[model samples]
Target: MRRFVFGALAWPPLLERVLGRAADLRPARLPGYAVYGTGGGALDPGTLCAVPDGGAEGLLILDPDPEDGARMAYFNGTDADGMVTEVRCGGDLVSARVALHDDAPGDGALPWDQARWLEEWGPLALDTARNIMAQYGQTEPARMAGLRPYLAARAWARQLARTPAPAEVRMATTAEEGVEILRDRPGHEGFFRLRAFDMRHRRFDGAQSPEIGREGFVAYDAALVLPYDPATDHVLLIEQLRYGPILRGDPRPWVLEPVAGLVDGGEDPETCVLREAVEEAGLTLREVQPMVRVYASPGYSSEFFHCYLGLADLSSYEAGVGGLDAEHEDIRSHLLSFDRAMALVDSGEINAGPLAMMLLWLARARAGLRAGA
Candidate 1:
């Protein structure tokens, strides 16, 4: 049976894997069915259902081979278990099948936009699929669904680190030349992944260190902007519940922090901060000044940050609820004068590292920035 991919299954690289060859996609229609989907990441899902007078527009998979059918059954959740249906391919209404999910969005579900999906989610999903397929047979589809969200984010983080920087300097040693990865495996895959490694690296003394056992948390890059009203000398901070502290059993899990978010795959950090400013704070950013590009904790995580001081007119913006309903972000912004922010810092009410660092950086550069504003 040929697989007819109407959703993310059309992701090119993935399509090639499923179809053996990336067969030319042609205009096709499926009648008596409506396509519905819900999922932000690979974990979020899609399915097709029977609906009278409803049809979906998608590409037809020409003549899939037996191998293609088998692989499709393995990876595409619906192919493995979804109900078989009929689709109109050219003049013939051939028998086809779809996997349906109950969680698929209904009523307001937009038609599948293939180009948009490839642009925004293609890269993340591509990498996520590779990681998932790599651990195939050892894990179940249910487990992959659970790991999908974080794995997608981890893919973005990896892409960020892989972003090329203009030549400024060259290191004496690169991972290729100085490090040998004997065995590296996924230790855990959830909101974050635990990666266990057996490797050796060059030492400062020009000798190879013995093979070491180490594990690290695979992290994604995040955008952090400290919104400063250079004209009024005020800064805006956000407070939200954080799971890290709560999981640690800290008395306070609510964190006071900057307007921050994960940088989507193929999105630049600068653009990410601007997008986040509106989504998280309902404010537009102007003249964003770069603070630094550094790892949150280099020793054990790949979480990187593109810190910035975003200029905005927060003179009227008040402490209020913010964040996206779909993502369940319940954020509150606090407009604090320089002194008030400092008081919070002094009192430990502001404990998030990014908030504290941004505040400190602003204190020293406040005069320089306002001078230009």
Candidate 2:
């Protein structure tokens, strides 16, 4: 049987990755259907929905292997339904399968803009597709849906890793110049991922080190903000039960920390911090100050932090419980004087590293901020 598939939002590179070969594509148009954008959030790409009447233009794949068709279905995710339809290809109407979604747009929904999507989301989508397709026959669609966010975070990490930091005082060598990766494989995948690598790197003495095996936790870029009221000289901190300490067998797992969240793929750190502030503490920030960007632990993890100081009015807001119910977050916000926050740091009460660092940072800038306010 000859198989054909129509792609409206699928980029050529993604199709190539999924098919494991160059795709045989032709320009085609679905005469009685329109493509609309649906279901993307800060962390994921919006997908396409084909609905009756208005028409859409896309590429048609000719004679895709049955296995390739299955792979494409997985890529489309659980929300998509494939239907055999006729599309105009050149001068003739040809039979092809198109993916449609149940949540079709109603009146006045804008048509899907392929150009804008390519510019803003192409890289992340491609990187995410690579990770998704790597699981090919191994992962189920329902399981893959749950894994998408983590995979997107990993892809975003890879994107951020491309920009080099200042290296004047350091080795001044890029990863390309310093490290030679031999084999990289997945150790585990869930809410987090563990990756094992066999690699070699240049030593300080100008010699290539022997190949060695190592493993690292794949994590996300996080935005951390210490909300401060310059007029009141107080700061807001949230207390939450942390899983890391629990895993480490700590008696006290509920720790006080800055309002923080994982930066969604393609989301700006400042924007993420601002959004997290409202979600975690119910306070809208008046201004935000960039504190520092650093690796949480460079030794064996990919976790990084973009820290900030958020200026807000603390006098009107009281300490209370706040957090998104969807995430099952039981967060308690605490409003305290600057001195009291520092006292917590001094008394070992504020054990979270990022929060403590941000507090100390706030101490140095407190005088100027108050004067300016």
Candidate 3:
């Protein structure tokens, strides 16, 4: 017999443990089960069902056990769709399986019993369920493909969870400051304005088109840097956790990016770059060689990054652990020769789009930057 796990309906702490373990077991698909689903309420049974069914076959549900039925009260109020969704969203199933060897919950907040599992997990479980299900829905094998509606059902369940949390925007003084704000408001939307919002204009009939905003919301209104040390033939790249890759199922989500951060209120972009360089990567940026200050992304997010080229002591600085501890930043700086860094970008080793663009910018200005250095 094969086994699968669901964390949503299981319990909160248990679910976290399960996800952590699941993360540990990389590049492997979890087992699938079935849902005797009946849908109602804010939870989308469809989305919940997709996790097991989409990735593997018939793993979300099992035949009702007479001995277990009395314990499965949470399944009682739910329909077949709801039961299955509860299971997927609950994630206890996954939690129970992956973390079976781990210690039981210290408190009653999460119970080991199956019936109590659904109650504790609740509709709030659907978000993680939807995320996992969506990942598998696109990739599920054919036999399990029929269970796709569970993904939809899970989505509905998530809507119910949303009623409680709701979405709201928070304000901040600067982009980095906005990161702090965003960290606090994990689920809710964040909105803030910073001093310098950079945009490029494509002249059309001598008139620039409506500006495009790159990156995400301009929540962190800050400056950007494209650091280059032509004398040392080196550049500064800072690595940190990124939400974009996290959403895309990347295991190691930290990305090596240019020395960039939010420009605090009353500070100029150049000042922001210099400060960020010292704080994030532990490098002293001496000369600021300005480049086209363009928005990183102009479509969805409001992050307007001001790109620049800075001359620094690439060899003197140690390329090791850096960043602010209060913010829980574990950034690793790489002081590589220009050719090596460009090669990494060219070979697709450097995945971040902004870093790639900045690298190319440095490539163009390498000669001049070196001459001046």
Candidate 4:
């Protein structure tokens, strides 16, 4: 039997990739329905939901192959369910399958705006789709849905990685001129992703190096902030038990560090730090001084940091515990004198590298900041 599906929110590039070359598409319209945005992160307004209206315009896929149908199901995830419906293509009435949003709210839904969405979310959505489809045969659709947020974060990391940096002291050759990716073998997919690459890069002497296998731990870009009070010479640090140290066999896993959180897709780093300050330590920061942006580790990870010095008044604020319950965070906030924080750094008590770097940065600017205040 020939199969036809109506897609109201399907991006053309994504549709081409999912439906394959054998499928055909044409303009179509469904009567008594209108599309609305769902407003989710990552692929914001994740998928458009249909509500009763005079009509809605969309695309009709004609005779999609069985494999294409399966791939489409996986792409839509578990929140949408498929059903056969009739839509008009030109003068003809066509029967097609439409993916309905199962939990679409009845009121206050905004109309779908494809142009705006494409401007802000198109690239990230495409990149995220590439990762999600790569695991089609191996991962369940429901599990993939659960992994979508993390996948989107990883995609956001790629976008942030494109930021141009000073290359005066380093080679001017670009990745396009210096490297070749022969193949990519999938390794793992969860909160974090792992991928192995077979590649070669141009050496300084002008010859391509031998192709070798290398694996990378894909991570999100993080916003880290050190809250400081120039008036009292105090800083706020949060203590939490981290998994990395525990995995590395450290007996004392609880470590002190600056306020930090993963930068969500389409979110600015400055905005992220301010939000983290409130969530991690019940502090509302009005403004932040930029510190330095750097990679946590360049050798085998994609973790990057946007560090900042948050200006706040900590003279009367008492130290206490704070963290989001949904994230299972048990964080304790500590208000320490500038000298006391440095003493901990000297004693090797403050082991987190970002925190140490930020404290040193504050030290260099402390006198100037205080003098001005």
User: Which candidate leads in lDDT?
Assistant: 4
Per-residue accuracy of model 4 over 34-144 as CA lDDT, tens digit each? 666656543543333545664666777766666765777776665444677788889998788766553454566666666777777878877777777777888878888
TM-scores for every predicted model: 0.71, 0.92, 0.43, 0.93
lDDT of 3 by residue, 8-127 (tens): 333333333223322212121234432222232223221222233333222322322332321221222221212222223233433212212122222222212334435533433444
Tens-digit lDDT string for candidate 2 (15-96): 7876778867777777766666543632222334546566677788776676766777666565454677778889998887
Residue-level lDDT of model 1, residues 1-373, one tens digit each, is: 5456667775557667544577766566777666665545443334566677878666666665656544555555433645566778788887655554543347756656667666667766677666556555666766665555556666777767765445457455667888998998668655666889999998878899999999987778898999999889898888899998999999879998999998765567899899999999888987698998878998998888899999998888877898999899999988889879989989998888888888888889988878977
| Candidate 3 all-Cα RMSD | 18.2
lDDT of each: 0.74, 0.79, 0.48, 0.80
Model 3 gets an lDDT of: 0.48
Task: Tell me the spans in candidate 2 whose CA falls farther than 4 Å from its real position.
Answer: 1-9, 39-53, 79-81, 102-104
Determine the backbone clash count of candidate 1. Answer: 2
> What's the C-alpha lDDT at position 236 in model 3?
75
Superposed model 3: Cα runs more than 4 Å off: 1-218
- TM for candidate 3 is 0.43
Looking at model 2, the pairs that clash are none
Q: Which stretches of candidate 4 lie over 4 Å from their true place?
A: 1-9, 19-22, 45-53, 67-70, 102-108
* Residue 311 lDDT in candidate 1: 92
- The CA lDDT at 192 in model 3 is 25
RMSD of 4: 2.2
